[model samples]
Target: MKYHVVTLGCQMNMSDSERVISVLEEAGYQWTDNEEEAGVIGILACSVRQKAIDKVYSRIHKWNKWKNNKNLVTFISGCILPDDHEKFLKLFDITFQMKDLPELPKMISSYGITTPTHLNVGIDPHNENIEDFWNVQPHYQSNFEAFIPIQNGCDKFCTYCAVPYTRGREVSRPSKDIIAEVALLVAQGYKSITLLGQNVNSYGLDKKGEELTFPQLLREIGELGKRMKKEFWLYFTSPHPRDMTDEVIEVIAEYPVLGKQIHLPMQSGDDKVLMRMNRKHNMEKYRHIVETIRRIIPQATLFTDVIVGFTGETEEQFENTRKAFDEFKFNMSYTAIYSPRPGATSHRWVDDVPLEEKKRRLHQLTEDLRKHNLPYNESLVGQTVRILVRGEDRKEGFLTSYTEGKLTIRFACTDKSMIGQFADVKITSASDFSLEGELVEVAASC
Candidate 1:
């Protein structure tokens, strides 16, 4: 059997799709990038935004056409909003949660496909073709830093969000399991590891005993990286302010292995707007958190997610958000115009923000971000920063990776094999988004 998977949404969804493929492969299914050649198809969906859901609905006809022509057994999974699941289930022959993948091979077995292990909880991906699961095979998609999911789902049900509805409650994988996986990847010559989750800081919160929060996990991983004979990079993402504890900041400050960047989602900057969004934290609390982080790691780069035009956002409220942005001086900001998602608590209220105003606010925010960002990069023009070279730059012969603070820097390197190695680069030029540099020294063998 052969299968094709279409993934959408965040890194968490991408990692889930890969695990689904791992399950299929374990059950003797082959992968085909082409939908026309597959006996089975998987649509790894995203339901965060109404626009995303509409695109999924639009793709139904294409999959239906494939089904009519070749009788493909289509399966849909990944971040599926609860309200749309019934409708999506009707569109595909099968629908299941990404978390239910352990039972997939057995589900296929009933359809006459064979597999090795019994369907049960705590099933290991390492049972068969372990190296492929770690993505050591030459047949894998890309060769660079990899996203290794350490936890799943979210606890924060912000009014405008659908992740909690689609991905269920937060659940953390065992620390031992994650550590072993990291060890395996490092042994296989992987240079970087990005620990992915909806709320990475909330990792291990539900686990038994003294829960391993994001900060604790960072410290543990930092210790492991320090002990490793080889040099490797570590990063995690999309953490909530509620869980951004002090220990995590200290770990990043103390350990050079962990990337000196943190992506904290500040959905809204106005206290009233945040309350309306059920974000829990106030502007004062957020400022203190950022201040603490800066105190702990002065050189740390910060990125954030901001939503413009949330319901009931007045001009003053928007200004408050702008003030927050100015105060933080974020390295990068992902700004979005608020679009109400179905089945979410906030969707019950009127989406009163006008489209034109939303765009205007978004534009204003972008312009302000530019004012702060250019000078920040300019300051790095003479410093030599270590970067893990990932791939060739899109525009020139230079290679690119990220600095400790997750800044994208490009530099000319003499060694072609330096793509996966860390090299010191002396900054020569700076842009709002990237730094131009010249390679100083490429560390050999690590």
Candidate 2:
């Protein structure tokens, strides 16, 4: 039997897919990159964005058509809102929460498809089942880079976000499991490891008395790096500004393995707009966080997420956002125009921002980002920075990689074997978002 997984959305979804692959492979199914060749098809769906949801519907429509002529079992999981899940139950052969992943083999077998009889059959009705889902060893897809999920779901209930509705309240994985995973990956020579969560800095607060805080977790991983004598970069993503503490910043600065990059999301810049989005943090607090980062980790690269033309956003409000952009001078920003999705708090409100105005705002922020990013990229010109070679670039004869600061750079290299290794590159030219460089030399592996 062969299985194919179509992953959509963030790295957290990708991590979920890795575990899904593991479960399928354990049930004697081989993975196929081509959907047409697979007997079992699954989609790790994303409900956060309407565009992503549209892609999921399009894919399932085609997959259902194929089912008329072939024997195939289709399933869907990952970041699915309650409404989407209810709808998916009718469309997909099977639809389950991510916590129910261990029972998937049995679910497939129940369809009259033969599976290993010795497979685990019982499903725990309690939270223990959720723990099992996290315990399932993922068949990691990347040799050089990996994502370890430290926490799952969200509690912030940001009005514009579907995460709280889809994934439920936050659940932090045991710090021991996280440390063990990182230690093993580091020992196996993974060059880059990212700790993934919707709001990473909020980790352990839900289990405050039992689990390690986010800063404490970093300290443990930092100790492991020192003890292992390995050279690798550890990173985390999408932390809420409200939870980003000075302790976390200090821990990051103390650790050499932790990369000097932060992705704090500023969903909207205007105070009223932020309040409407339920971000729980003001512009003043956000500014303070950035100032702290600069003061502590002076060489750190800053990245952020911003939503433009949010509901009821005025022209003056957007101008405030633009002013915020100018004030922060972010190296990069994942800017998106607001789009209401069913099941989110914001969905009930009228989407007052016009589409054309949304597009205009998006473009304006993008230009602001580029204007700020170019100077930082330009500053790297003539400097040699260490990069983990990702793969070949779209431009022929060049290879693609990212610096420790997560800056994308393409360089001329014939040695394809260097793709998974670290190398130093001399920046020759700079663009708004990326850099052009030449390989200085591959770094010696630890």
Candidate 3:
């Protein structure tokens, strides 16, 4: 049997799909890229974004249609909101949470598709099964880049978000397991490692006294990097401002392995809008964290997530967000047009922001980002910076890569063999978001 997992949403979902792949492969099912070739097609979905949720429905519809003529097993997993969860149960052959991944093989076997471990019972999917989910050896899709899930779920239930309803309470994975995975990946020549979580920096807060804090965890990893003497970039994402401590910034400043890139999500710039979203932090708190990042790690490229339209968001409130773009001068901003989602707190409230207005606001923010982003890239015109060779670019004869700060740069490279290696590149020209450069030197992955 062949299987294909269609992943959507955040890096956390991508990491979850890795474990899901592990379970499917263990059941004697071979992997497939084409959906038509697979007997088992699973979707690792996201309920956070409206578009991703829409894709889930569209994909399952086609899969179900295919089942009219062919014998196929379709399953759905990952972060699913209450509304989507109910609907998915009626659509997919098997519907389960990410924590219940161990039950997947058994559930599929009920359809007469037997596997080696189909009869293995007594595994409770509803209990604290996230720990067991983590124990499943991941079949990573990428050889050079990897995502290590350090935490699962969300505790801070923002009003406009459905993550709390979907993922449940926060649970930090053991630091030892994460560390071991990181060490093994580094030893196996992985160049990029990102720690994944809903609230990544708030890692140890759930288990306070027993576990290492986020900074402590980074310190341990930094020490490990120093001992190993390998060239790699360590990154984490989407950390809440409430959990963005100065200690974490200090740790990153002290560590050589930690990438000079920060992705702090500032959902809205206006204080009133933030309060309406129940984001738990004001604009001032977010500003202070940005100040700390700039002061501590001056070279760090700042990235953020922003929502354009929310319930009752006024013109002044949106103008505040526009002003914030210039104030922060983010390198890359993921601007989202807000839409009410079922299972989220704000969904009950009237979605007053018109769709056209929301789109206008999003486009305006993109323009604002371009105004600031281009100049920064232009400043690197003649500077030689070390970048990790990621892969070939859309334009032939050039390979795409990223700086330590995660800035995209494409340079002429006839040798695709240098994909996983590090190379020093001298910038010749710049675009709004990417740069053009010439390769100066190449270093093999250690």
Q: Model 1, stretches more than 4 Å misplaced? A: 109-141, 208-210, 413-416, 442-446
Candidate 3, lDDT over the whole model: 0.88
Q: Lowest lDDT 10-mer window, candidate 3?
A: 116-125
lDDT of 1 by residue, 143-230 (tens): 5577777666677889998777776677777676678777767777777778888888888777756567677778888888878776
Return the TM-score for candidate 2, rounded to 2 decimals: 0.93
Q: Compared with the true structure, what per-residue lDDT tens digits does model 2 show for residues 1-446?
A: 99999999889999999999999999999999899999999999888888899899999999999988999988888877776766776678877777889889888878655442322222122233467888889999989899999888788888988888788778889999999999999989999999999899999998878889999999999999999999999999979999999999999999999999998899888999999888999999999999999999999999999988788999999999999999888988998889997679988999998999999999989999999999988988999999999998998878899998899999987668888888888999999999999877543421
TM-score per candidate, in order? Answer: 0.90, 0.93, 0.93
Candidate 2 error regions (>4 Å) = 112-128, 442-446
Better of 1 and 3 by lDDT: 3
lDDT string, candidate 3, 1-446, tens digits: 99999999878888898999999899999998999999999998888767888899999999999999999988887778766776776787777776768778878878655542342222132326788888888999889999999988888989988888888888899999999999999999999999999899999998999999999999999998998999888999779999989999999999999988999999889999999888889999999999999999999999999998899999999999999998999999999899887679988899999999999999999999999999999999999999999998999878999999999999987687898888899999998989999877643321
